[model samples]
Target chain A: MVEFNKISGNVWNIPKSGKMLVPATIYASERLMDTIKQDKTLEQARNVACLKGIQKSAYVMPDAHQGYGFPIGGVAAFDPDEGIISPGGVGYDINCSVRLLKTNLSVEEFMKKRHDLIEALFVNVPSGVGRGGKTRVDRNVIMEVLSKGAQWAVEEGFGRKDDYLRTEENGKMSADPHAVSDRAISRGLPQLGSLGAGNHFLEIQKIDQIYDEKIAKAFGLQDKDNVTVMIHCGSRGLGHQVASDYIKEMEDKYGFKDLPDRELINAPINSDLGQRYYRAMGAGANFAFANKQMITHWVREVFEKIYGSVEIDVVYDVCHNIAKMEKHKIDGKLKQVCVHRKGATRSFGPGREEIPDVYRSVGQPVIIPGSMGTASFVLVGTKTAEEITFGSTAHGAGRVSSRSAALQNISGEHVKNELAKKGIEIKATSWKSIAEEAPEVYKDIDEVVRVSHEVGIGNLVVRVVPLSVMKG
Target chain B: MFCYAPINYINLMPQTENMAEKYKFLQHTADAKFQAFGKTLGEAFANAALAMFAVMFDPADVKPKIEREIKTEGKDEKALLYNWLEELLYLLDTEGFLLSRVKKITIKGKVLEAVVAGDLVANGYKTHGDVKAVTYNEMDIKKEKDKVIAQVVVDI
Candidate 1:
């Protein structure tokens, strides 16, 4: 069993041992730590600590939960010279991300046509299992989408040029489409704008509370009156294929002998396979960026069809699952490192060159979408985050119960009815899904956000509650 | 009336009923996990495919209206299982086909070929979930004296 030392309030350390390059640190309150200890999440975090070239410590957020190889809310940075890139660190959904759009319509105005709006959204956004989106493209177009990302969508008339600015990496990453396998491309071709199954969704929300008026105003968020839309999705099939292909390649070429787990199979950052996987993963991430852009366009059209050409500007788009080469202070010197954040969000602090200019003084917007019928928050990055957690924050209200266990305790019909009674409209492909994603199945969003705020990893700006939900 | 009573009544049960279950689904906090059991390696592989599809929809709801053959090669037994299941996912995502049954499977060294039957998604056919891909995480194929079992966790 792993032992912990309470170094400080809300902070614990798993001392470096047995092939560990660094220690493991967890940021959680005593109460939350009790719940976190119930799972193998900390064990996974300890496993990450053993990885080569890991700098500082393996960091786990307060909302951390068990995942395949890495905990859901895990962060670790590796030296570019000697470290390795594990696909599991990025998860299957390459850039599984969330985007928020502020609309001109107020809650009262939107409620007047809520039914019509929900219907239009449900019809426009192809959702659920095995469902394809409206856009169908051939291989050539698929390559373009992978290469140009959201820019391709804008040029193709799917969104505005300014939309990219609000997105991480401006909705485009340096990608090599040729490095991606044809099978991956083929799998993603028909599902361009789809909101895929299992935890993916599109929801309409209204601001319920504002903690920091300055930051909230900077994000263009208003109190109680303004309505917003959030889209939670990812790279879909293409990303999954990239991760699978690379993991297999690493096993075949590098061999998996002595590795703690096959799921952590990785290649040296500078190796040919590693570089190839990075490029391909980036391409898959681009596909996701383009996919969300297309969905945004459809959303705009629906709002326009109902409200007549209303303004809908993207507040921010942040990826929860990904790895990127970044420059950070390590051992009192700035060095390049590959920061892997699986089920974690990048919370770059104030004055970072990467953040959009408007919010540079404050920080990048870190969005955390809650489970269906729960409250989501908008937070800003902190300098402390960059120093402690590799500039990362919690991704979502991490799951506390298994899907099957949830099925036993919650009834889909009942959960749907309860949300409906609370004035939140839900449209799902199947009732079974409602049960699996019941709000109670997740950790408390308020507590998770409180820890994040108190730790200074991310500071809360606005909290929004669901007005309507579109589940896949 | 029935004078031909079997020496062992339990042994006289139908072979299908006497056999171990094809597969059983396990619970992962975020994703689904399963273990497939069979008396032979091929059966274990075939059952693993069923478990993957079962996570998406009830197998009873699907019919063998369409048939397709698949062939894959891996460096080892673990890779072989990974390749086989991934091929099934490829079909689901590319052709919108759901697996009803594995008609046949043949494994030679690291290569595998199989015949799968399913139906085209249409008005009568629908899927209840989407499985993104088969993962190497906690993936293992074990062979015992009387049976073989394959364990896998899929990213949904």
Candidate 2:
């Protein structure tokens, strides 16, 4: 019933109206239209279009849904010349992402060790609300962590340096720790290595189906039977407090008079307010990278202890929602712009200087994880992705229902028993968690992955089926 | 999915009228009930203290009433609320104390001022997740034309 200015099949535009300087463009499938019909994400899209100096169209991916300001599945690029950066756009879990680690161990091998492996992981990695990690770092060391990210974790005996080479932005962007406030450091003190509650999980999966054998072999995913661990987490309380700290400042200190949602608080890109927020946000990003890296070390240790030895290796770690400076061809001229991807993964195609050398021919490996009971995917970047979506693709199966609604409709205990019936062992702190993350509450991931393929954003590699799951 | 342990009990703090004197024992939903009213935010915070204590036993039952002072400051009103609630929770967690009364309170802008008086005691135990932070998603700051009506979504 609402009017949205049309752009093209790959894009739908929201025209500049009432303080808007740019149009909004949403990239979605025909099926995703209904979800947008029921929410204000479209209006929010238009609102983002209104922000000053928006370099390109304010964009939303297929998984777009209502969030604090810009939709969770949203993206917007701002002019380094004249634009604004908002913490709400990046969300509280700054640099929250998924990292895939492939092991020589296969599905059949995991089946033999499933019960013990799942149980050991559950005990080793602390899960649930207000949980503290088994490791701790002092305030000074944490500051270094804010600046160095996974490199710090590796130097601290967490993982190998090569793990950084395969990660986005080398696991740490240019973060200046002095910009971070002590409060952020304090809030993050206890959350290091903790598997915080909600949406965050560590799933052990096997490569079930290989769609592209040559590309799969090139990316260290050679075996269709090899197992890989996918860790999904974020900056924890540190990032939450960082975003919380900035939102209040943006609301009270810097006021954008006519933005649609007050939650979409922002500041001019070059201003001190903007600079401080970005650096602190980067610190949070570092915290998240370090967190996953530290956990990676423990994961390896646990495997070694149980299996006597592990021939495991890091695959790739990429952020789902983040903002980074990149050079892309616009009007056949290369221009450097800041790309803000909210709940979207970068699918940089071939020959991009930023991508690793091994992936130069096959494009970057994109890991798409479904729920514990559903099938996950491994996809490769494509040239079509670079031309159409700024080299981005859908992150995962977007939520189809609210948490409360899910609780009312499904029983956690029942879902657990059902998954067990499927031979997937579930280890969690509480059944409430199992209910909250029921696979049914999310969009059909297979459909989502299918759309991405049809759209030519990315091509499917292999399907990874779960043998066991662990959640916070 | 966000989940909470449903509240299944009848308990409220006693109240009196005349602004400072008027307070009520109220349950907002399946998870939370508090003595939420005030001549000001500080008074309302004080009542919240009483409500926390009442969750365990009759507020009237705690004998030899003792007193303590708690102060917390945050970047904004919402953060202020979190720290304020957390301070009270720390007392309950560390000191095993439940507050029963408030002698005085004041709220000037974001600065919440209150003097909470109570005793160190135990009440009926219920398995509860320590409240982490308050959320702003469904936060309510009701105002009837000009009068301010207080309500908020405290993330537990």
DockQ of each: 0.51, 0.11
Docking class of 1: medium
Chain B of model 2: TM-score?
Answer: 0.60
Summarize candidate 2's per-residue lDDT along A87-183 as a digit string, tens digits. Answer: 8778767888889999987677678877898889888886555455777678888888999999999998998988888888788878888777676
- Among the numbered candidates, top DockQ falls to 1
Give lDDT tens digits, candidate 1, residues A1-472. Answer: 7888998888899998888889999998887788788888888999999888889999999889888778889999998989999998899899999999999888888999988998999899988776778888999999999999999999999989889889999999999999999999988987898888888999999999999999999899955798999999999888998999888888878887877778888889899999999999899999999989999999999999987868999999999889999988988898899999999999999999999998999999999999999999999999999998989889999888777677779888999999989999998877877888899889898888899999999999999999999888
Docking class of 2: incorrect
Clashing pairs in 1: none
Q: List, in the given order, the native-contact fraction of each candidate.
A: 0.56, 0.01
For residues B1-156, could you state the per-residue lDDT of candidate 2 as single tens digits? 111111111123343334443234332221133335553455445545554443333455554377667667655554565556656644543344555555545445555554555566333322112233333433343434322334443322
lDDT of 1: 0.87
lDDT of 2 at A316: 86
State the TM-score, rounded to 2 decimals, of chain A in model 2.
Answer: 0.96
The superposed Cα distance between candidate 2 and the true structure at residue A403, in angstroms, equals 1.1
What C-alpha lDDT, on a 0 to 100 scale, does residue A109 get in candidate 2? 67
Q: Residue A54 in candidate 2 has what lDDT?
A: 75
